[model samples]
Target: MMKKIVPGILTVFFLLISLQKVQAWGFWAHQRINRIAVFTLPPEMLVLYKKNIEFLTEHAVDPDKRRYAVEGEAPRHYIDIDHYGENPFNVVPELWSDAVQKFTEDTLQAYGIVPWHISRSYSWLVSAFREGDVDAILKLSADIGHYIADGNVPLHTTENYNGQLTGQKGIHGLWESRLPEVFGEGYDYLVGKAQYLDDILDEAWSGVREAHYALDSVFNFEKILTEQIGSDQKYSFENRNGRLVKTFSKAFCTSYHDMLDGQVERRARISILRVGSVWYSAWIDAGQPNLKELIKKVKKGKKGAENKDEKIEEEKENNGHKLKIIDRESSDLLGMRDVHEMLFGECEGHGMGVGHGHGRPNKPHTQTAQGQKEGLWPLRMRDL
Candidate 1:
């Protein structure tokens, strides 16, 4: 009785752990992508991003979290482009308006809208930069980094995302989560500096097309490898976060990683470069504002709030220039609602289930109760 109960308990625990990790690119990868992208920024923008690096890194998973909290948030993380047909890129229009006209907004939303959402997020980031809203800029930067990372993920571009249809269930987590968490330390992330993108939408589609092109290898190699290594040797139990969890054996992971010929590393590097380029492009479009000045203004405002009696020091630091101090609390009020409303025009229904093919059942779409807008900012400056 004791033996049977222990095994059952362990099974439940492992399943829970696996479920938590099956999101797009996994939280660890997402944060790493965003953190590394910061280093790729030019000095002009680095001054601000460096100071708030932690905020950017930690908030990289905000969009994933919103899938469970905000209405219509899941679709922004992925696109099942394979649903469109053999030549999905050419079959589906690149522009959001054009695609909507061809497929209807409801039809497109039913599958996924990651590429279009990337463009929308990019525009919002440009707006945030132009407005010099530190909070919004940070928030949108982190959020856009996530969508861009997702766009580069091969799994995010397919309807069979998790391998459910092809009997390769759990492949999503194995490829995106387990492989990266295990071998990512050795990856060379010095992906050089970010360049400004002339056309954001074209860049976004380019990534999707490249990722989609690799889909056959992502699936075929795994299938071939699995046939070579029997189930007994394919998986093993290991301690993760202090608990024994069953996962793809290290040998199997190594085989698959080698079989892919550095595909995971390539995608991750691309994500970093693309994230930085998108950010730099947004800054350029925003009239090349001095990010260093934004940092100084934020610090001055924070200092003034802390020492109200030091009006003389504040004035002297201002150097006769009027400092347009942003109210920290008020500025921080911006959340996903603004982005959702900006792109989709409504934020009413709960989002679909975890769209990265985590094998979870679709979450029922229902109306969320009012007044639950807390924890929505992608980057919370207060914590910074």
Candidate 2:
């Protein structure tokens, strides 16, 4: 009786743990993973993307669900970058080139793309194609959509990233998830073909730089308009969770539109459209194949097995864990209870249309961000 009860309790504990992981990665993770799949898509699958908009429709919420032919390609978030260094930013984009050499197949025995960092996503696709599998390609295409979508976001690339700032807190969700929900679908999906990137690191760093520059308007333009426009016009009343709430105002939209000079939405739409195109491009580049061939070599999703077998498999994976494929967090951070996780977890509370903390901190960063040379330091959670 004791043995039976213990097994059941263990099973329940594991299930609960799994559910939090599903929730903690947030909507962006799903989107980012799709971009990985995009660069590996085959020709037939590529054509399907343009012929139909259904992919975008069904996947906008959780795009990473599309499994690539390669097992374990779509993975849990949190790159194991911390293991390699004290601070990734100190090295800058050099990490990307290093990743290329590391993935170039020195110690690695298999012919697959490595998942070193979230930013190295594109490099993985470029190499995965050499293996030549259709299912693998499509899987990466779906993942590509996710990353490109995240790229369009201003916060994902910034350190002030989450708006732990001057009381305009939770602006991260407001800008990326909220605004897109209300206004994104209406965006035009007709962007030009994705030009082949000669150097992925250059493109990636360029993206980071672009997102960095946008921080000026995202963080400052709101304040600039406040001096001239009335407060009421900058927000609107809406019912959320049966509660009447004042949200962003028409004047705020107008001001942002002015700040972007009308490029924000267009760029977003371009990102989505390019996501599809790249997915297709990857399939073509990957040597368009029959998905059936790849299906023969790989299986989809995990299946339940006997307890002993499961234990053995888990132990095996744990022992052989590769930095190229794993993301990690501190034991304390990973072990926090649900409510604690929701408040502090990477993927909850502030996502989408939820909440914004918008305020100053008791202690703020003395320095500003990279592009903000005018100030003593980039304004952080304290300045808002």
Candidate 3:
């Protein structure tokens, strides 16, 4: 009788563990922007674009509670040397870790490859339109907005991530999340229609390298100004909860402005404008024609809603390898494997996708409220 009850209890225990992983889709505002931008899909391919949009919107945030916004926060320094044992980069593949294919695949799998992830997302966007429809091009152009915006962020790429070694631990929060949150609205929003970007990987890497290299100045300037920045002047009044919140004061802002010489805000403005331009360019690539007519063309060319669900049935049957986890939903695309290799890289075998890593034990385990709710002891998530 005791043994019979054991299986039931275990079953209930595990299901609840995975519940925490499921929550709001994205933590980054950019991801939220990407969610809304999908609507810009050309009318002809609107339905397909929506499908892809939903995919990205679903898994925009981290599933792990410990690092819910891991990527959202850049690393201030490389991991402690002791953590990696000896000669760190040897074991952990970073920047150029995997072969170009695998590396790119990994990038697409994770958070930092914002531009490529956005690009691959667009492939599904392009597929939604008619083969020859010009109007479909305009919509694709509009979708480029998000990827282009990604290119502007220096933190979007590189190793010395969030000023950890540089001693500015919260710098990631200040620049990427907070600054943008505060001043984004004042920036220019127009960049004009996008133009074709030649050799997208090179462009993306260049963007990464530029942002990565910029870390030097980002840290240096802050350090140099630290002495002059008084606690009171550096922290002042910002309205919050119907009361003023003490925060970066006008003095700090003035010093930051002096150091940047207008570059910080300029880059933000450029990012905003270029996002709009790239969106326009991708549309041009699809051949700027007419929206409604192209919509009819796609409806006739591809299997619309009638055959849509069936397209992914086979991918589902075979080990879940063909499923692309966008936003969080598993989009079972027919040629995801081929395109996955062509655009991103050679994907790992089944179970190697982002956050779904194999053999991880600490992933929250299903526990009844009466079970190990307070804390998990010696048995790790892997053991569980």
Please give the CA lDDT of all the candidate structures.
Answer: 0.81, 0.45, 0.44
Arrange candidates, best TM-score first. Answer: 1, 2, 3
User: How high is the lDDT of residue 193 in model 2?
Assistant: 49
lDDT pick, better of 2 and 3? 2
In model 3, where do residues sit more than 4 Å from their true spots? 1-98, 101-119, 130-148, 237-239, 242-246, 277-281, 284-290, 294-384
TM-score of each: 0.76, 0.50, 0.49
Better of 1 and 3 by TM-score: 1
lDDT tens per residue, model 3, 1-384: 446545644654454345332222213444554455454434544544455565544333322222322233222111222233344335434333353354454333443444444445355444433365443333334334445444555654444456776666655555665554555455453434334553444454444445545555677777777766755565678885588655556566557656756555555455444443344344455565455565567677565644544433222332323432232123222222232132323323211144322343434434334332322222222222
Best by lDDT: 1
**After best superposition, candidate 2 residue 133: deviation in angstroms?**
4.8
Error of 2 at 246 (Å): 3.8
Model 2 segments more than 4 A misplaced: 1-57, 60-91, 97-119, 123-135, 230-233, 240-243, 273-277, 288-384
**Worst window of 10 by summed lDDT in candidate 1:** 367-376
Candidate 1, lDDT over the whole model: 0.81
